[model samples]
Target: MTDIATKPDSIIAVERWNTFWGARDLEGMKTVAADDFIQWHATVRKNLTKDEEFDMLVEALKVMQITFKNICLTPMNNDTVLQQCVADIAIEGAGTRNDVPFAMVFHTRGQKITKCEEYMDGMSLPPIEFTPQD
Candidate 1:
């Protein structure tokens, strides 16, 4: 694990994000997020607030065996981190499972994550159309 104080703020933010998800710690996620944090997902149509993202994660964790590996995190600048990972997902929906690729860009403010935009290779049922309101 990389120490936050020793690395750049972007790295710290991404590390915290990974840590919380890896442990499925919803409360720990809140601690590292700004009050107005928002996340956009490639699979989802709408942008999600911090609380909403956590709620989504809870549901996903229940049906999927998700694991992130081969994470390559790069600090795009002082406030942004770009990360790519292979997400091994075993989704038990109607008895189907698959591994997927994932990538994200995280923006940080101080020690908290202000925004995260994620890209995933999967299909969401009902076919969502992304409409950016922000």
Candidate 2:
């Protein structure tokens, strides 16, 4: 893992984002997120706030696990970064699916991520038997 202190705020934010998913560190995810953080799933026409997303993750983890591979991060500016990766999703009963392409643009302010726009093939995700809480 890269040292957060040595990197710029954008880089630190993206690093923590990757760490959160790759390591399933939910608490670590909170540290780099802004209070008003939002994630947009453009393809699915869905949006999630920081708290909503975290709650979804809590439920999702019970039936599936995600790991990232071949991660590439490009700093678009001081406050934005483009991240691309192949995610391996292991669903408890559905079996593991590898090389599912995923991409996101992270917007950050200081050490906190303010927003993320994600792009992925929704159909490629293996079905999991978990219902999100209301």
Candidate 3:
């Protein structure tokens, strides 16, 4: 990881976003995300609004712990960044998966993430059965 002080605000925002996820701090996630935030998942072929994404994260966190390693960040411009990392996901009752390749393009505005384009290997994910809430 590079020195936080030397990093750009866009990178800082991205780091904070990932940090919030690892810490399972939903509020922190909200703090860094713009009100109009949208995430497009290439592998899943879906677009998720901020609330929708948060809901999914909350559900996933109930059954798994995720960590990131070998992270690489590239600045696309003043407000855009590309991040690539190996996600280490450990699912309860399913064992751990290491080095699952993941990548995302983040667009930021004033320290808040406005949009994210995500890519991942769908097959690398462990299946989890999520029961619908009543």
- Predicted model with the maximum lDDT: 3
Q: Per-residue alpha-carbon lDDT of model 2 for 53-128, expressed as tens digits?
A: 7887798888887788899988887589999998887888788888989999999998799999988887776554
Relative to the true structure, candidate 2 reaches a TM of 0.85
TM-score of each: 0.81, 0.85, 0.85
What TM-score, to 2 decimals, does candidate 1 have? 0.81
Q: Which stretches of candidate 1 lie over 4 Å from their true place?
A: 1-5, 94-99, 124-134
lDDT of each: 0.76, 0.81, 0.85
- The sequence of per-residue lDDT tens digits that candidate 1 reaches over residues 1-134 is 65655898778777887899798887888899899999988775468988777777777667666678999998887598889987766656434334467888888998789999889855633232222334
Off by over 4 Å in 2: 1-6, 128-134
For model 3, the superposed segments whose C-alpha errors exceed 4 Å read 1-6, 129-134
Q: Residue 88 CA error for candidate 1 (Å)?
A: 0.5
Cα deviation of 108, candidate 1, in Å: 0.5
* Residue-pair clash count for candidate 3: 0
